[model samples]
Target: MQKYLPLFPLNLVVYPMEALNLHIFEPRYRTLINECLDNGTTFGIPAFINGKLPGFGTEVKVTALSKKYEDGRMDIKTEGIRVFRILDFQNPMALKPYAGGLLEMLPMPEVRPFVMVGLVERVKTLYRFIDEENTFDVNKPQPYSYQIAHKIGLTLEEEYQLLKMPTEAERQGYLIQNLERIINTLQEIERTKERISMNGHFKNLDPLNF
Candidate 1:
């Protein structure tokens, strides 16, 4: 079944079960948020690249809301519900910055616990390295697939690929491939650092002169 929903395009990719915090200041999106509040409705979040919306997006539930000012601005926290594919889009002639679209729900496969656990472990290891190097501070390990996806630095295109996968196994496979690549890249960096250190030590050695 296809239904029309208000669309909110963003530069970042949102996955199922992830939480996002948004500040609503634009007039059009503020109207959209108000509509959702009035009707207990959900909205679609599509990735925007070069001002173009991706065909696939996630439906999100507004879990928390607060009015920010007398001007009707709002601060909202939302969690992703499910994936949807855009069937059609309509852009009114008005000056609204956001776009609205007709969307069809995408079916999700039951993900296995073991596979999910493995992926989580991989992400944990990656974050551990980040914390050790003081590159970033993530409070705790994320508990769900979407959170893991966000932490792994997946591009919007790659995230769309995950959303399009028809089965849990396929998504797991994709995550595993990305995890392997990340691990390899980190290892290469370590090797390069070791080589540089060794060269510096050799350069410092006292020269033997006859």
Candidate 2:
């Protein structure tokens, strides 16, 4: 579906079903959130990475207006609904404080059991090594790969790539590859640390009795 949505560009990627809490302080954004809350509407958060705005982002809807300050600032909770590709960005609409953009909603693929299982096991190992083994729940329904992406130490660029993936299977594959690379790096670091530690330790050698 193609439609116009209020755009919030940030240096992070939000995945579907992910909950995000935002503090609206800028006058533009404050106005934007207020409009959405008042009208029961949604907004698109386009990925703003490395000083550039990406073509894709997730559409999110406000779930709660947790606080409103006397200065017109707000604390709101929102959940991502789906991914959208920006068609064109528009400056603030007439009499509006924030910007709006045309977007094409993308098709979200169904979960692939094989991919999910493989990635889940790899992530389990990763967490165990890091002593955060209980951080992720594999049995949870719709445990999409992004849920564990941050836990696996994926960089913002890597996360953006996962967000751009056309299917959950592809995302799972990406996560598995990423986790393997990170795990191998961590193991290497541990070995290096062990070697370094041994260098300063006393080697107990029996004095030769002449």
Candidate 3:
């Protein structure tokens, strides 16, 4: 179904179920947040890359107002709900400080089990290589590709592409390919570092020390 939503264009991509914390300093956004909080509505954060708003974005609902300053600035926490594609954008909507757009919801398909399992393992492996504390929960009834997207060193554009994917299997496949490339690059870098660290080593010099 087509619907209209308040627009909050941001330079970041937020995937469904991802948490985002934002500081509202601008008067327009402050008002927007206040209205959403009052009405219990959601706002769209369309991807703003290279000064252009991407057609696709996530709808987010405020979860908490962590801080409210005396000056009216706010620190808010939000969680992404779903992806929406903008059918038409209205800048400065009806003389309001914020923009509005017509959006079409993009529903996600049930995650394919085999694909999700493979991707989860790949993600865990990538995290291990980087020595990161793995917090991925693969046992969830429905695992999402976004759970590992940010952790796998995906570029903003790549994340957006993953967001645009229509099905869970496709997203999982994209992540697997990306992780493979990233792991290979990381391995090459580590090898180069090991070679560089031994640049001045000499067997004859080591024998004298011994």
Candidate 4:
């Protein structure tokens, strides 16, 4: 469906089903947050990359306004609902201080078990590398790729690319590749550390067979 979305560009990526907590202090953002709260509406946060706003972003709803300071600053909780493609951007819309845009909502795929057992196991290994193995509980509700994207040490650009993927399968595939590459890099770093630690230590050497 096509509609207008209030835009909040940031340096981070927002994924559907992800919960984000934000502090509103700027005069412009204070205005934006107040309007959304007063009208019971949502906003779009696109990954602001390379000093430019990207065409893709996730639409998020303000679930709660936890605190409102006397100066009008706010602490708000939001949950991303879906990905959106910017059809047109209107900065300083009419009398409003924030930006708005014509947006096309992108449908997200239904939650399903990732069939690749290798990828699941790899994800487990990934968690182990990062000392977060306990957080990768298989029994918990699977939000799939978005659940673990941030935990695996993905760059903002990688996360942004992942957000644009329309299907769960495609996102999983992308994640699988990244996980393997990261795991290997971690393994190499560990090996290097071990080698450095063993320097100047006495070692037993086997005589070569002539």
Candidate 5:
């Protein structure tokens, strides 16, 4: 079903169930947030790629107004609720300062057992490589790929690509491949560092038998 969503174009990609804390100082966005707060509505945060509104964006609902200033600028916490594909955008929606567009709500599938398990292992391995004592864990109940997408070293474009994938299995596969590549790269980097460090050290060398 297609419905109008308030558009808040951002440089980053927000995944479902991800919490985003935003400081609303801009006049237009301030009004937008205020309206959403008053009306109990949601907004779309479309990833701004190369100065353009991209294909997919996450619909986020404000969870809390953490802080309200005397000047009307406020700090808000929002959680991504769902994914939406933009059909068309209006620069300024009717009389509103912010933009709004018709969006087709997309369905997200549940994480497949096999791919999700591998993805989680790959993520844990990535964390171990980055931090010797790894303690990163996705939010529980049902751990999915979005929980770790930002935690893993995915570029904004890559995250957007992940969002474009309709099914959780596809997302999991994408993340697993990405994490594997990253883990391999880090391993190679560590090996290079070890090789470089060994350059100045005197190693006990054994003569090769001819």
Candidate 6:
């Protein structure tokens, strides 16, 4: 079925089962939120890569909302409900910051449990590395898709490819491939570090007295 949705173009791709928190300060998006709350409508979070919104996005349900200021600013939490292909966009006028769109929901595959678990584990490994290197907290509840997607550091383009995949298995395969690449890169870094340490030890050796 086809329907129109309020569109929120963002720099990140949101996957189904992922939760996103957004600060709503722009007037256009504020209006969009109000409309959704009033009418029980879903919104499209089209991925904006390199400053352009992609043709496909996910439909999001507003799960929570709180007023942040007297000037209409809000703090909101949303979860992805389904994927959507944008058919058309109503461009923003001079005063509005958001766009509206016509969209159609894409079909989703019934993902097998094992596949999901594999993807989740791959993501966990990646996050562990990130936490160790960057001091990022590791105890937060992981979002099913974010773990897989964030681990490989997928570019916006690569993320779009995953979103366009027709089956859950295909998406998992793509993630696995990326994860393998990440693992290889980490191994290479470790090897280089070890070689550097050995070189330092050789330099520290006592000078030969001839």
Listed per model in order, the count of residue pairs whose N, CA or C atoms clash below 3 Å is: 0, 0, 0, 0, 0, 0
How accurate locally, in lDDT, is each candidate? 0.74, 0.84, 0.85, 0.85, 0.85, 0.74
Model 2 ranges off by over 4 Å: 109-115, 204-210
Per-prediction TM-score, please? 0.81, 0.91, 0.89, 0.92, 0.91, 0.80
- lDDT of candidate 1 over 1-210, digit per residue (tens): 676788988887777767889999999889888878888999998877667776888889898895567898999999887788888887741455567888998864343233555765677777776664323223333224444666676776887777777666677778878987897788799899888888745366687999
Encode model 5's per-residue lDDT on 1-210: one tens digit a residue: 788988999999988778899999999999999999999999999999988887789899999999999999999999988889999999899989999999999874353233456776887788778775555454452237777777788888898999898777788889888988999999999999989999978889999999
Q: Better model by lDDT, 1 or 4?
A: 4
Q: Please say which candidate is ahead in TM-score: 1 or 5.
A: 5
lDDT ranking from best candidate downward: 3, 4, 5, 2, 6, 1
Tens-digit lDDT track of model 4 for 77-182 = 9999889999999997777888989999998645554546776888888777877744655444445788888888899999999988988788889989998899
Error of 3 at 128 (Å): 2.3
Model 5 regions more than 4 Å off: 108-115, 132-143, 206-210
- What's model 4's overall lDDT? 0.85
Candidate 2 TM-score over all chains jointly: 0.91
lDDT winner between candidates 1 and 3: 3
Candidate 4 error regions (>4 Å)? 112-115, 137-142, 206-210
lDDT of 1 at 122: 74
What is the lDDT, from 0 to 100, of the residue 195 in candidate 1?
Answer: 88
Residue 82 CA displacement from its true place in model 6, Å: 0.6
Report how far off residue 62 is in candidate 4 (Å): 0.6
User: How many residue pairs of model 3 clash at the backbone?
Assistant: 0
Let me know the TM-score candidate 5 reaches against the reference structure: 0.91
Candidate 6: Cα lDDT at 26: 82
True-vs-predicted CA distance for residue 11, candidate 6, Å: 1.1
